[model samples]
Target: MRKSNLIFIFLMLIIATSCDNEEAVSEQSSTEFSSMQDGLITLKSGAIVEKKGDDFYYQSDMLLSQKQLETLNEHGDFIIEEPDQIENETEIHPVYNIPVEANEDGPAVPRAFGLYPTPYNMWAMVRFVYAPNLTADRKNIIQQALQHWEANTNVRFYNATGQPTVDPVYGFEYPYIEFVNATGNSSAVGRIGGRQKIRIAAWQATSVAIHEIGHAIGLRHEQSRYDRDNSININLSNVHPDNRHNFNKYTSNYFAVGSIDYNSVMMYDSDAFAINPAIPVMTKKSDGSTWNGGNVLSNPDRSWANNIYIPYIARSDTYRELAPVVYKPDNTVMTPSERLALQAQLNNGNPNPPNCCRLPNNF
Candidate 1:
């Protein structure tokens, strides 16, 4: 995984967009439709619409009236606002498309034998762009984040000497980390081979970078809104205007089953001015476990990493049981043990398993 490749993956995940059919609004005479006092109209499906009474509407699969035709022409011959917005004036959820590519080879190897070891001796280069008026102490917050992960995960961080490039390869091997400053409007964290890089928004706080690093290490978003049983109660009629886009996008791939952790460091607290009410508050685990509320990784987070990390790298039988599906194009498929063995060889310096399981590839 070269740095360039890692960046490409991150870009694909965060910036990719897809096209969907826009729902057309049926229009009526000004007399038939009343001017909305709230400046918005709510539709049955929970979509929000800006009322342009008698302004324009799509009819019979095309712009009908001369006024509607003119409005379409003025707007460059396309449906301007999303239909969901018209139906629900309060909040419109944003949709994220996860790229699923077909494996040119065969089905991915099973976790029992196919997992790869994490690159050791590599350094993650961290960089921050703070607001011009940000206090000097604010920068220290990033260091604190690094120290926090290192103390918990046993990884090391290194400082880079010169301007960072979008290099593809990471450190000499694994276990080392690097930090760099990137100039861009996007705030994200990525890993290249052995090195990890984070780009920060100058006006944003450092906590965002810390969260990105967690992504770099293969953690998924904690607030997956897809599971109906996750205990989220969103008010379809009164959603915050700012979070409408993201709220709509929450789904199973990003969220997990039976839980949504609002306190996850990886979650976004605010977008624009409206606070995202859909964000789930962290509750003690079903077993009554608790996590420190600030700046620290919680027990579930740590346990999740512990359970998945080693298998992610080593692909031992135990690790494979943890990750049964190697998501690929066309569908979510099960991985084979042989594939896991190969991956382990590619990743772990020594793919040979301990004396106990010395069969064939040894992994």
Candidate 2:
């Protein structure tokens, strides 16, 4: 894969946090592998298995002869097993530049509110850690990513007067994209409208930016190990020997009910490091189909801006039109029923939360 693509993969791994813990458990049981598929063996426990060489045993202990063990040890420890898992963590961040009324203020209402008159002709604001230098290759990559979005959709990437120092008058906002001189690890944030923030890393692959952009436009991981039949190609000889013993330590708790796709851009490169032993296979659709061309808006070589909605605004015609409205209650203390009603309203249709104004000190 190209360096840009690799960087994108790393970014995806960084931004994509596993929702559940992956600490390894004591060896519950062991199973022997009888066959290899795509260079990996599948054990009885559903863990993908691999052998380093003729001398290495699939089990943790040195089950092979002394000479064989020495020969295999030179190569690296064998991978006996690994779990099929998917990450479920969600990214969270505060909406920048939006003002909140004091608790003493009256019911908070949105300052400026309304949807764009048109459905698809929306704009997006991208904030980076640093401005892209004119000569930097990243500038091209960023431009490509944006153009990719503009090509198919009716959206446009607007040039703002200044970086997103404060909240916008309207529309969606993203973190500033900075160009770091050194390579290895870089990150980007994909906030779909205002529902959630998805961070993307730059070190692993260039496509990482594109992948996070996909999330920003509402695409989920394709290969969720949670689903059955997810698989990846592996070279047994290249398996990190010492890391083999602790493989189970990285298994995610989430599962997807689907078949696997090996060629997904969402999948990690074979040589990439697995922070936990049970590295997740690239995510896939529940049915196991690879991502079709149109699925992603931006790619490593291109940039595109489009409008995609989360569940809260599913009913709204234009996602860009929904603004956060704050409400402040006159009475400091809200009755239990009122609190429940407020929560229901927020959950049901209103995107903004109710801001409580002044309250009695005792209450």
Candidate 3:
């Protein structure tokens, strides 16, 4: 399987870089895997599932800091230590970034939370379930967050297709996200396989949901990029002790994409994890400013998202444009059935089947 992807990638990389300027290609394709000369790495296990290439990531765990994932000749332990059962935990950072330390287990190979080598292919039918008790507005907020990601890049987040009569009361039977109530907002870094979650708190602003969806779509905080030390300063003394690690800087080993994305939605804010507002934890060297780019998707953020997943966005996947707009004229959210129907109308035919290895989702 890796061989075929490598072949396809070689052709695609050549075709994508044939433009007069090679810098454009590098700027666009520099993702965790796309930027590498090494082929993408596929994992053999996830939090609980043993399926090959299925895994999840949290923003604060071991996989967050590598300049790039070297070949997985040495597959480390599951980067994030998930709870024995997600249901047993009230809340968790299930998706945060921390340094990868090579222990007695030999050396640590860089790996993203989960493998999402084909995110764009699975974008149209990304399945998710909101906690039933959520109010209409709260559900709308969640849906709005999904649409925000879709609009910025070539992706979609809609109701799970092919409903089953019996669904698991607690979670889905397949790879899915459960947006349940929790103290603060959190989500798995990527497709963790099987049942995963995005816990939303009542007080979290809509932007928080947007940030969490970034994780679900396989993104880590921009400030935590392994190459971030070159762009900003992370002051540990000002940051609260418990959250000090969050400010850890990646080394010179990391690769950078785009003109340093200082205003990405994935960046931590100026006062993040800091006890004193006077002391800026992350000071931007460009102007000695603290990070403040989390409002909306920055140009670099959108570009990297598309580039990382570009392998799946066929120049011919025009049918995706036909996918129903998640937001209505008045900013209301659309349902999955409505989006499907719109897609059918646009194709004047049947939509594509599960091109990716998506599991059954009756539950």
Model 3, 87-178: lDDT tens per residue?
22212112111122233433332222222233221223456776677656567678778767777664445455334423466443455667
Each model's lDDT comes to 0.33, 0.30, 0.47
Q: Which candidate comes out best when scored by lDDT?
A: 3
Residue lDDT tens for model 1, 1-363 = 334323333332232121112224345533334444433434333433333333322210111233223333445322233323222221111222222122443332101100111221112222222333434443465567666654454233333323243333632333223433434212111222322334343444555545645654434344323432343433434445633433432221121212344455544332212344343233334443333222355443443333222222222242212123332212233257634543443334344444442112110
Deviating ranges (above 4 Å) for candidate 2: 1-135, 150-161, 167-181, 188-208, 212-224, 232-237, 241-258, 269-363
Ranking by lDDT: 3, 1, 2
The Cα error of candidate 1 at residue 185, in Å, is 9.0
Alpha-carbon shift of residue 274 in model 3 (angstroms)? 1.2
Q: What TM-score goes with each of the models?
A: 0.36, 0.32, 0.54
Q: What 10-residue stretch in candidate 3 is worst by lDDT?
A: 46-55
Worst ten in a row by lDDT for model 1? 109-118
Superposed Cα deviation of residue 206, candidate 3 (Å): 1.7
C-alpha root-mean-square deviation, candidate 3: 16.5
